[model samples]
Target: MFAENKLTDDMAEIEAFLVRERAKVLSEAEWKFRMRGYGYNLRRTNGGVEVARLPQNTVLGTLAL
Candidate 1:
């Protein structure tokens, strides 16, 4: 039916939005990791993904150094 089709379309749209948001978060995380001397890890917990910063050794912080 038309309603079912509409529901499917809406779900697809929502999924696309979520994917874009996740990509944005990942891009920002990568930028921080590269530009700043930060390490990160993505973990799945409680049915959601979490971005966590990891501790780094003082001697090997950045790529340039």
Candidate 2:
């Protein structure tokens, strides 16, 4: 299938794109959190678990996992 044709290089490219997208999500979450208060942040680690003071931002972060 299409998956087989995707070389390791192609796979790496995809992963990079995904990571960039995930960073975007995290930035958005951070913005939302900062809007409400200080000393709060929305962040997602490589493990895919999102720890955010805003709470609901964690739901979208599962995709990064």
Candidate 3:
């Protein structure tokens, strides 16, 4: 649905969309901290930083497929 050209990659676009979704879900402080790490940090907390992986084909909500 977001193809800009005939050869555009849909999975790349979908990944970008998911990144945007994750950004939107984070708080302002969390966003700033995350941006400071060059988008490397996945789990940010008072305990410690931990990298996390999301499952494939995972639905976020009723609005998400």
lDDT per model vs. reference: 0.36, 0.39, 0.39
TM-score of 1: 0.27
Off by over 4 Å in 2: 1-9, 27-65
Name the candidate, 1 or 3, with the larger lDDT value: 3
Task: Give a tens-digit lDDT track for model 3, residues 1-65.
Answer: 22232332344553454356456755746653543343322444554333322323222222122
Candidate 1: residue pairs that collide: none
In model 3, what are the clashing residue pairs, if there are any? none
How would you encode candidate 2's per-residue C-alpha lDDT over 1-65 as one tens digit per residue? 01123433243443454455446555666543432352223355677544332323322223255
Clashes in model 2: which pairs?
none
Predictions: Cα RMSD each: 16.0, 11.8, 11.9
Q: Would you give me the overall lDDT of model 2?
A: 0.39
